[model samples]
Target: MPVPRNSKTTGSKQLRPGKAGAVENARPEKEESCQAKRSPSSPQGAPKKRSAFGDLTNAHKNQAGLRKKDATKAGPRKAQKGTAALGVLKNNEINLKKATRKTPPDEASAEPKLVPKNDPVLEEPAPVQAPAIEDIDKEQLGDAYASAEYAKEIFNYMKEREEKFLLPNYMEKQYDISRDMRAILVDWMVEVQENFELNHETLYLAVKLVDHYLVEVVSMRDKLQLIGSTAILIASKFEERCPPCVDDFLYICDDAYKREELIAMEMSILRTLKFDINIPIPYRFLRRFAKLLPLPWSQCAHASMETLTLARFICEMTLPEYDYVQESASKLAASCLLLALKMKSLGGWSPTLEYYSGYSSHELHPLVKRLNFLLTYQHDDKLKAVRTKYSHRVFFEVAKSAPMDMLKLEVALKS
Candidate 1:
């Protein structure tokens, strides 16, 4: 046996108890103890606690904490991937909201568009403003004709027919105008209407014929009102039933026009149109063709009126035989509306189709396109100087949509 310490060894001699007594004697004095390893020392002057048995302790405990840092390093690649995935999911949710939301029109708060409000296609297209000089020889004024003398000669010839000759007895029931003057008035009226942005169709046609007849007999500046009035009168006879009388014409002048002057001019114009009262205008042709094309009546009416406005600009418009008007009414009307709406700086023809057709404007595109092509051919560059093209004699004296309440005048001796 190993040699024992003197008093310390003797004190440790309490051993070898019975098995049951030994188990009871082996119970711990503390509740629970940690398995501690080597322990670090506390700082100087820090309080330290000792074990009850004075044994070196092996237990350790950790306290959660964040260290003071200069900068937090970014996470590992896997951690970064998880963050990116979260961001992507957030972005997807945002995209879904955008896809489903209904955005209002940019100008949805504005008032309803009157003209075609979509596809506003306009360039700075200044209309070819024909000269204010009514007497420009068609050859010099418009490209359609040449030879100023021919233009003047034609004017005189037409004037002579109205002034010196009487219509044949059989054709007395017809309305007539200076043949050459007729087309000139129509063409110029169209041009003027375009410039002024006035959309009165009846006014254009009436002014055209009036202006023409005024030039036909004599451009007597003093008799201008009479010419304008007489031209309107003839147009009234053609365009409206129960045509206005001298008194009504005077009232329309707002007392500025005179009765005797209009009466005298009326007689002169009557002689020129040869009293063949049944001169048909494009308005009639428009109604017939608009029906033929199955265009909406109101829309077609607007179109025909537009054609009549354009007629004021067409040189040949004055001589509209029934066949000519029938052949080109659709194209002419559409061109007028297009040019008019374009000048107004509104959207293209679709709005018109929507308003008039009760459907989207797209449906009328094919017809509108075809009509555009047809009008394009009508503008022949070679005819710019034509004698009859430049003069204003063929159209009305004043363009005002003729009044509906005109009184019928009995120009001929009552049978």
Candidate 2:
């Protein structure tokens, strides 16, 4: 016979039917009562016992959820570590915030640890570099009208084209028109420019046309006025928004030349120059070089305007003079600006001007001396158009401004 085990349903022991037939001991009543008190009040059956594999699966799911939650908490800490010192400072600020929220309202908040600038753990960041003084065009990059991107290229192209248009002592080739006559014509052209409110570029281009045409074609002295009028007419057409008609130019000449003659002369001038009349003018160059002035002084802005006006007056004086015809427009403009700066007690030729103008102070010294001489003593009493026009208050009376002392100018050149 088989031995019998205790019966869970009856809570009693069962005896084996073999030899001796001993009875099994019964469970204590106290243990039974304890189990009864621990049992659930609902009529649900007991839970099924889980296997080892099932327990492992449940543990893996719980671990996956816990890992996701931990990664969510550490998101900001990873970002803080990526930023180096700035990241550390931000992390400290976050910790201080957390500590403040956790602290009781009655207690004082924890003081934040301030990092010193010279600390090895958190040093100051490197300073940003300053903009170059010579690169003035970069500041105007925001201004569409400035054309800052193309400004350097345009001026460089102009300089290169200047070699092609360089003039020689063309008067030696002319038989009829004299230098004095040319001066008178230029003076009259200036007057016309003032009278008709023509652009300064128009006046300069007109003069260039007259010179270039005079160099190539020799004409009778009476036809000189016709050439001047025709040259200005072409320039007006090239530069003016509403250029004066041929009749208007003929009228300016007191009807000395007929409209047909003026129109013919215009074709002649244009054809002689091959219709490429984009001559670089000293006025344009002077304006460009004058922008290098007013070097960081509070009052230098107004002084720069005066200095520029003085330079302009000096440049205009050379327009009528026959000697300066061989000089390049850029050189003449640079020299005039340098001389003006000296006269105004401003600084000498700086690296910024030299770099932009492409002329050293030594190279400009001779031209500067000659321009100064012209400003002081070479004024033509007969041709007073430039002087009289600049002496007005509108031009800041720069024409009336006295020249610098010769010794002082010499000293400035050396120093």
Candidate 3:
């Protein structure tokens, strides 16, 4: 049937089956087109067109490249971890190789090198050797005394102890005693010592006790004799094997002190000195050095005895002189021995003497000259007890020896 041109039913009547299917498809296409137009109103629609400048911008290009790079990197992450571990191992291998490589000789020679060869520039130093026991014993004995390996040790020990008992200055100031009065006391003590036949060590120690006691205590002149007597009494007991009885001391002092007074002074001195009575004296050192004198025994026995007597006289003379309190016993001994050698026309000071005495002749010259002056110049007749003691024949009459001339002493010293 023919359809009317403007009627929808007529148009439907003119449609074939194929045409009808096409019409239905056409309706869906129109619906889709309407939906596409509505989608532009939403935010998630098709991209807007870019400007010319935006297409040339580097930020978008860089972002695109980064995205490509991140995509590529994502696939190799596990392999990249293995490769990083390989690189660290390679670095460790290189460090070990460097550490194990031997240094070249040219580089080693740049530093100080110890070589066993005898080349003067590279020779090693020799090791030090300790002194032999025999050498030490010889040195300790000083070629004179009995061989005592520990003599040097003993001397050093005594030297350390000497500092403790060093007599202080102003010793006489603490007492009513003058230097002259002390000298008189020492002279009388010497006489008493001889009368009692006491050892010379006892006499020296007694003087030390008196001096040390006087330094700590004040006393009247009347009590000075008592103090001296008590000192002698105490020293005798300590240094003597068979000390005299108390009655003997009283008899020597002509009954000047009773037994009780003697005992009291002894206790007072011991208290003041704290019972430390062992003190070094010049007499001991003098005797020790005198034994070292190289005398010509072939000529006569009197030669050795005379030299020792002169040296002893000089040492005893120093004891009464208060100015010599500071002089060490060893030094005084050396000086007196040297002067005795010179006075007797024996050989002058030598290296052997220096080694034993521990002092050089140059160091001993001044002391030697002072001793000569002491012998030659009569300063005090009253202080001549030491001289008178030696003037007798029993003491070798060393005090009767010819006076030493200054010119002769000067010549001897220069040589």
Question: Global lDDT of each model?
Answer: 0.36, 0.72, 0.68
C-alpha positional error of residue 26 in candidate 1 after TM-score superposition, expressed in Å: 99
Which has the better TM-score: candidate 1, or candidate 3? Answer: 3
**Candidate 2, pairs of clashing residues:** none
TM-score versus the correct structure, for each prediction: 0.28, 0.67, 0.64
Candidate 2 Cα misplacement greater than 4 A, ranges: 1-132, 296-299
lDDT of 3 by residue, 1-415 (tens): 1112244333222211110001111112222222112112222232233322224568988999999999898879978997987787687997646644655567677555454355765433442232211132443233222325455565556556667777876554756678888788888887766544466678888988988888788888889888988899898788765577777667656667789999998899998899988877776666555545676444654677678778878888877888777777778888998899999888887655666567888898899898888888855777666777778766767888875898999898888
How far out, in Å, is residue 253 in model 3?
Answer: 1.7
How many clashes in candidate 2?
0
Residue 394's C-alpha lDDT in candidate 3?
Answer: 67
Write the number of the candidate with greater lDDT, choosing between 2 and 3.
2
Ranking by lDDT: 2, 3, 1
RMSD of every candidate to native, in Å, equals 50.3, 42.2, 52.9
lDDT of 1 at 306: 38
Of the candidates numbered 2 and 3, which has the greater TM-score value? 2
Which 10-residue window in model 3 sums to the lowest lDDT? 18-27
How would you encode candidate 1's per-residue C-alpha lDDT over 330-358 as one tens digit per residue?
A: 33444334433332233344432333223
The TM-score obtained by model 2 is 0.67
- Candidates ranked by TM-score: 2, 3, 1
